[model samples]
Target: MTALVQTVSKSTLLSVVSAIVLGFGIITVAGHVQAATLHDAAHDVRHATGFPCH
Candidate 1:
């Protein structure tokens, strides 16, 4: 009975950790996408307005 309880507890803990890790990964990817989009927009704006950043 104790072994069974331990197994269940371990499984639950692993599941929770996996979910948290997946959430963090998603957030990181979203942030990267947002940063890339902002960079592209800034590049386009500089070209359009003739503001050199070089």
Candidate 2:
């Protein structure tokens, strides 16, 4: 009985950690893509118009 309880606790801790790591990875990747999109748009606008940013 004691062994079973220990195993369950360990499994629960592992599950929680996995969930947190996955969440962080997802958030970071999404933020990166959003930043890249904005950067591309700015670059394109500068080329499209001869007016320089003062």
Index of the highest-lDDT prediction = 1
lDDT for residue 27 in candidate 2, whole number 0-100: 47
Residue pairs of candidate 1 with colliding backbone atoms: none
lDDT tens digits, residues 1-54, model 1? 678657677779789789999998864444333465654656655556554432
What would the TM-score be for candidate 1 when compared with the true structure? 0.45
lDDT string for model 2 (7-32, tens) is 67777978877999999886444433
Model 1 lDDT at residue 37: 68
Q: How many backbone clashes does candidate 2 have?
A: 0
After superposition, candidate 1 runs with Cα above 4 Å error:
1-8, 32-54
